[model samples]
Target: LDRLFARHEALRSVFVAPQAKPRVEILPPDAGLPVSEHDLRQRADTEAALSDLCHEEERTPFDLARGPLIRGRLVRMSDEEHVFLLTQHHIISDGWSMGVLVRELGSLYRAFVAGQDDPLPPLAVQYPDYAAWQRQWLSGERLQKQAQYWREALSGVPSMLALPTDRARPAQQSFAGASVPVVIDVDLTRDLKRRSRQHGTTLFMTVLAAWAAVLSRLSGQNDLVIGVPSANRGRREIEELIGFFVNTLALRVDLSGEPSVSELLERTRRTTLAAQEHQDLPFEQVVEIVRPPRALDHTPLFQVMLAWENHAGPSFDLPGLSVEAADGLDQVK
Candidate 1:
């Protein structure tokens, strides 16, 4: 809480003339932090309470946190197991921030259990600090040259993946996507590793190539557009700091002929290298500067996304928790 909004002056800057600064505040001691241990229909109920919570404060957009933006009620089914119902205002949190928040919550909870009131050191910097650096650092001749390469490489490229959709796209360009994972069996995985070693390409490059091939076949388009998220935090200070510190790199492939997996992989490697070399630019900026034709029928760039993430560590000693994979929520592209 101390270092979180520290860097983003917008976070700390007040929306009201009366108040000087915005801040993250802990609820007073003996505050009954209501918790829901089960999947309960408490969003409406809790939000009503938080709405009242907001009314008590000044009429300021920034007083939202103290309201109910990130509402996580404690769910204490038993002494050993207590979970939280975490909800956030999309304005302050993104997919990346959710992961970071959960991890930090776990750390803080563990520290409280160990009788430590305050837990964790101040981060060397925060997202705002990095944002400032990015605005200043990503400029000059080097940035321009790399951008020139991107412009030439992406010129005249179609922006959509042509995935078959059930209904015609809406005027608003709303999209819903799902992904499915087909894990290789033990024997198949072993053989795949042996072949990967022979080809001298890492497992990720091979998998990305195969996925690209599959998409090319499904879409019936000779060209494939895939977006991969790259962690843009190269500096040590912001490595652990949390925010939307990621950039999307568009991976394009021209599958004119039925290229072998090896050939596809070589192209994929070249494409990835080019992306990484100039990935410092953010997607929003790219769109603004490139001035792609604004069309309701087209996405600004890239269609499909491929991602690999590691969230769990050492995978042990978690208790009183039930984890289930629901097919409805797990959608595949």
Candidate 2:
């Protein structure tokens, strides 16, 4: 963990004056880890206790300006069994960072166990460098070029979708929400993949079009905007870095005239490719350029978010320790 902190500057960084003249402060390498240990071997209801711990860790908010935005907890359930919980603020990390974190952590653990020197190569670029590059490269004419596309694409877009709900929307929007898992069985999963290939689209594009169709039918609206996350790591150098590089893309799902499935997929393919081409411009900037009506009740451009995480799940194989992802504990959520 200490090695990870040293390797990645983001782990040691904190935001200052986030609302005004925002900047990051990287702490010293000597700063200690925030990991805590809890012994629950004497407890009878270990599973229940573990679940509560997970929820508590997740719900505890981070102090962005004060310092460390990441946390760790080690729970000793029995003589050999243990659970490791890690939490971090979204400002510092994203979905792709998890795979990098786990893989590097495993490599470090293995090398330490064998009494070998650090085997991982030095990072060519840090997260701060990437941020600097974005500021430098994505500006002036480049920014305007992409900004024009967003303005034209999102011209006169509806402020919000007429999504049906059992209860009325609150006066103000809140982050409080719960997720229910939707299972896609093997045959259906295979068929979806097959259909994606048949339509010359990726699985994400296919599922996205289908989700837009469902939302259109449910809301009784043909025009819809759905928010999707784009892993904004186009450069290979940034691929192994740990940072918040994910960008949101508001896709205009035009479900007019009851188009056939194939036609919809084709349309989706074109929209997705175009969005990808213009994805370098951050979502915040896109929102600013689009200039949708603002309200306290909902987000500006889109309400529905579809995150199709296609990254491979991380696997941990520490020396003489069994690690498996706990049910109901999602890192993404």
Candidate 3:
């Protein structure tokens, strides 16, 4: 864990100054993670206890200005069974960084078990270096070009999708939500893959097209805009680096004229590709460029967000343990 902290400077960094103009302050090497240990073997309902403990950790807020924004806990269920909990703030890391962290941790664990030195090479660039490069690259003419693309793309977009709701929207927005897993059977999955291949499109594009159709039905609106997240790790240097590099792209889904399925998929493919070409522009800047009417009850640009886990998932190849994800503990609210 100490080596993990040393390798990723974001683990020891904190944000300071006004919220609008926040700056990162990297702490000294002495700053470290305080991993608390717990023994749940004595408890009769060990799984329930673990779930409660993890939920408690999730609810505990981090102090962004004070110091470390990550927390770790090790729980022992039996002689050979143990669970490690890691909670981190999104300011320093994103979904892609989590995958990188887990992959590196597995490599480090295997090497250490063999009495070998750290096999991983030193990082070529830290989080701050990437931040500096981003600011430098996205400026002047380059920035204006991307901004112009968004201005034309989102021009005359609807303020929000008229998604039917049972209750009235609150005055303020909230992130409190629950995730319900919907399973698509094997036959449907296989057919979807086959169709994607037939159309020369990815599963992501096909599913996104279908999703836009569903939203069109629910909202009774044909013209829809959905927000999609991009990893934004086009540069190889930042691929393995642990930091927050995720960007959101607004995809305008046009379902006018009751287009056929194939036509809709083709349109979605074109929109996705065009957005990817100009994805370097941050979503916040895109909002500023479009100048959408803002309301406290909802977000700007697009209200409905689509986060497809289309990238590689976390890989944990530990040596001598039966590994499976624990339910409920993975949820963040």
Each prediction's RMSD over C-alphas, in Å, is: 7.3, 2.2, 2.4
lDDT against the true structure, each candidate = 0.59, 0.89, 0.88
User: Which runs in model 3 stand beyond 4 Å of their true positions?
Assistant: 18-21, 43-48, 331-333
Which runs in model 2 stand beyond 4 Å of their true positions? 18-20, 43-52, 331-333
Candidates by lDDT, descending order: 2, 3, 1
Q: Per-residue lDDT for 1-333 in model 2, tens only?
A: 888988899888898885588889997887865889989999999988988888789779988888688889999999988888888888888889999999999999999999999989999999999999899999999988899988988898888899889999999988889878789999999999999989899999999999999999998998889999989889999999999999999899888999999999998898889998999998888888888899999998999999877767888878977778876677521
lDDT of 3 by residue, 227-256 (tens): 999999999988998888999999999999
All candidates: TM-score: 0.70, 0.93, 0.92
Flag regions of model 1 displaced more than 4 Å.
Answer: 1-69, 75-83, 89-100, 117-119, 164-167, 176-181, 310-333
Alpha-carbon deviation at 332 in model 1, angstroms: 22
lDDT of 1: 0.59
Question: Which 10 consecutive positions of candidate 1 have the poorest summed lDDT?
Answer: 324-333
Please give the RMSD of candidate 2 to the true structure. Answer: 2.2
Candidate 1 lDDT by residue in tens digits, 95-167? 5554555456556656666767646676677555676788788779867876787776677777677878787
Rank the candidate models, highest TM-score first: 2, 3, 1
